[model samples]
Target chain A: MPMWEESSLVRVVPSARPRKLAKVPFVELADGRLQGVVSSGSDISRVYVSSVAAGDFAFACRTNNNRPCGGLRGGFCNHVTALVGEAVLQYGGARVARYLQAETAEAADAAGTAAVPTAQQLTAAMSAVRPQQSADGQAVTGQVFSRFLRHLAYLELPATTAPLPEMHWFPTAGAVA
Target chain B: MRADLLAAELPDLDEALAAVDAFDEVLAGGLLRPQPAQAAGLNALADAVAGSPIAALVAEAAEKAAAGVAGEEHLVALAAGRTALFGAVHDAVLARVDEATGRPREAAPPFEPGAPLPVNLLASARAWLCDVARAGWRGMDHELAATAAPVVSALLPSAELRRLAVLLDGFAAELAASCPGRTLEQIPLRRWADLWARGMLLTQPGAIAAAGAAAESAAGAASTALTGRLLPLGVDLHEHATGVQAQVHAVFEPADGGPARLVRASVSAPKPDTVVGAGAWQLLRPHLSLLAAAGEGRAMELTGMPVTDEGDLLWSDDRAHVGESADVFTTARVALPAVRSGATAPLDRHPTRIAEPVLVEGYTVDGSGAEVAFVIGGERLAVDTGRVPAASPLTPQAVAGSRACVGLLRWDAGRFRLQPLAVQSAAKSKAAVAQAGAWAGGTSDKNAAKAEKAATDAVTVLRERAGRLLRS
Candidate 1:
């Protein structure tokens, strides 16, 4: 039990949800990238694994089998956009912006009130950066999908208020958000 | 050598927290079950810190737990001590950490602090009258006279604020005829005296440091903008002899990260009879949408908002724009601060706690209604329902069933109590989070159906009253 500092409330400008999370699940900020599995619109059985690197905004989107998404034309595909939106939901806009180092100078209004980038702006900013697809798309896809499957395992536990031994590291104090 | 010994002998902060966490595991399961290991850990910690400030109290509690006294009273006392000890230790650890990090502590203000008073004196007079009446007019007259007489006498000569002082005296005199007793602490006498002092202080410019500075700087500071997730908790309606006031209780999450601020918007009306508990929301509906986003929190973009030093947001309707409504349970569970357990002695003496109070979450209610204690972070904090508004849906039954709650945490009646303003039964439930009562003014979808009839009845009565007043 390390003595935590006198905790201060963290202020957040909650990101606007421009897209529903059903399109993208298993979104995470990990391994220096925003990566997740996204559902294919036309084919329910098909799924796309997408990722966008933090800096330089380099991105890659491919089917779990490493087939390049038809929508990827040197810029973000729909799957990448959905990944960013879901990431905003999981980790707030301020955090996502900080992670990606996204430009916020243009976010200010005429009166100069500070505003957080909308999902559309953040996605568009990612698009402006010259698209650099990762070479190991299949390996990244396998990693994220396995993580998603691992999360689903949590639902199996019988519900109880008692603290689980495995989840003890989770901060018991005020929420960081 | 003694200094070295004392430093080495000090109780370890991490061990204390770990011990409390372990104790919470046992207490949450019900105190009747024995856990020898947990008791031994506490007893060892107590033994380890013999001369520390809390050693005796901790040792006493550990003794009771080790004895396996299965009595309800023993359990209750253990629960109280557990909550108090956690807070005290947590604060002490933070203070030590701050010292180690060389963080500058807040400098104490030079002047003796006075009770914070609202700007409006007329409302204060009416509220004081209400409190006196509610307390069966007991021994309040002498206390009222003793507090008010000097303030009124001081202000009588000032022609500008004389009427306000006179109004305060009238309320005091009205109660002096009956209700005689020697008990000074029966009602919130300090609250009554706060308004009196406020009136007297207003007559002299710059008498009170914070209030005076706020008044002088308000013009230049009005244009500051704040953008954040605004969670409207519930509405608190104050009914006095002269009128009714509905204060929309809300918290503002800043765009960056630091501390959340308590933002409040108030609407007052002269018609006290027509505007009651749940009905007051109707009057405020036109000015603020905070009520609409009560249980389910909202993201807000605002410009030109004013804030007090105490972190109270001054509501300016025209300057604010409401954005998306967030998941109520997630917002309540993650965004709100955790309740810190400790002796509320510092808070008890003050007329008003100057620190901005953001609502607390992650608490499960134990006990029923006003008698309830919030079991949170492994400690049980009791609820003092005396100040909770009648329109709030946080009833006795509501307390028991709620899985999560969002409410203002206050120090009252010798302990910290969570006055739940909003409650969520389950995550992603259709209603999301339901407001504790009818105070939302049909804003919360959960209570919208219930508040509809009450608001409608209030409106019809208002229309009839207007017709008669105009005709006469």
Candidate 2:
């Protein structure tokens, strides 16, 4: 039930399929190191992040142990936080950016010549600057949207950009830097 | 003299012949008369013989006349003739004595005791035949009367035989009435015979064999009925508790050399590894010995096997008497800490006095991912811990940890031992980590020390944490 909160952002892969996504990056904040691996898919994939509540994060971390030590104050350990960061960078954040840019480009071509860009088109145009690689050797364009920064990096975008929906961010002053 | 005498005899002879004819008719009718009549006739004939030489000839002529008569008739004729002769003599005498006699004086004969009487042996024989015939007819009548008496008495409807028939009819009527809507008349005679034989056997030693057979059949029917009733109830109760299809197997046996019976049932259902509690033996402490003894030659048999109220097995052993007093409660408690939520409140509250021997050992997964082997209750069980293949749908953690776990703390061989699943896992993990570190460092000796240190550290951490929790 706790996973329902992130339902809109995450998709559950079919249990039968193995290794649908590749290259998850794990960032260790304690040692300032980044580690990434291309994992073969499994029946259960839980990404633990320190940004989540300590109790919730510990539960995710100890999924392997099967016994969830309930109500731990600061979460299980750093092992889980690194795993979550890697999963987001590899699978979720890059995929969303490419989809937005493609949709905006298609909408622009369909309109008459010298078509003025909408707010969504402007956001998509800025997201086109970041690039990533798909598993099939295809280029994946990243999104530069203000919301993308808030979600993937847990950072607040400057208000100088076009008007965007207000969103509350978890306290992560040290995680992003 | 000649004419008068001759005429007198002639009249006697005529009278005798007529009497003979009448006696013949009575003899032919098969009747017997009294004995006096024929004796007097023989006396007259004798007197006539003495009177004249021609008297013999006259008597002969009289006999010839009576010859046509039967034996009884001849005797009658002779008797009449004797009487007539006497009368004639008296007449003759009176005529001779005319002066003395008034109104024909009668000459009286003197009585003589030794006089010979003519008996006509042939007539007597014929008379005896008629008597014999009459006696036979009388005897037949008596016999018929005797035979009729019992038969008629029986027909009168109050004899024992008749009464029994009536009672049986009444009994049959009552039986029919009791079972209304059934066709009583159609009942087979053999069935009645069988029932009668059964009833007789119960009361009489003569019927013992039949009675025994009936008893055995009845017992079989009762056992089948009991099984049918208990089976469904067991299944329903098992499903209610475990939320799975419960399979039940049962065996019922008549007690061997005992009056009591033995009924055994086993139930199996899928159980979540997380759900744990004391085993069935712990709950049913009072009857453990009996259960163990009863289950001795049977498989999947356990002493004090846990059962629901409906006789569904919650836990069972693969072999009987193997874990007769294995302390299931401690085993379940240690194996599943998730169910307990890691609370050890009960241990301090009810301290168990350890007075027996025990041994302690830890096991873990080898490099090949096969579980470490350990022994409990004299049976070896392995916990499977393996990494999930990358291609597998199951995650690495679920593969490594998903196991049917059990733990035991025992006093054996003069020592106390604790065998817990957590300890097993920790040992396996440490070994694997050491082996990996050794390979990475390219020095087995260095890695061995490192592994020992790591194990020491882990044990120290666990002890400290457990102590703190127990103190709190």
For model 2, residues B190-265, the per-residue Cα lDDT tens digits are 1222111121111211211221222234345543222111100000011111111112222211123222111223
lDDT of 1 at A44: 52
DockQ for all models: 0.01, 0.00
What global local distance difference test value does model 2 have? 0.24
Question: How would you encode candidate 1's per-residue C-alpha lDDT over B1-472 as one tens digit per residue?
Answer: 0111112223655565444444443432222334676576546545544555656665776676566553333333343344344445535543432332232333222444433434444344433433332232233434553344444444333333433444454334333322233332232222232222333323233222332334335537643445555655565544332233455556567666545645555544332222344554555555555555553356566555555433345455665777787554555455544322112222112312212223444666677544667665666655433334444555555555666665554332122344555666644554445555344545444664465565565455334333332233
Each prediction's TM-score against the native?
0.42, 0.14
lDDT by residue (tens digit), candidate 1, A114-177: 5667778788776766657776766777766654543332222121111111110111111111
Superposition TM-score, candidate 2 onto the true structure: 0.14
- Deviating ranges (above 4 Å) for candidate 2: A1-177, B1-472
Model 1 misplacement above 4 A: A1-177, B1-229, B233-237, B241-243, B248-262, B337-364, B368-370, B376-378, B385-388, B426-432, B437-439, B443-472
How well does candidate 1 match the true structure in TM-score terms?
0.42
Tell me the tens digit of each residue's lDDT in model 2 across A1-177. 322221111111111111112222122111111112211134223221221211111112222122231323333234333334343332332222222222346445766664434434433443344322122111110111111111222111111100000000000011011
Q: TM-score of candidate 2's chain B against its reference?
A: 0.14
Model 1 chain B is weakest, by summed lDDT over 10 consecutive residues, at B1-10
What lDDT does candidate 2 reach at residue A45?
36
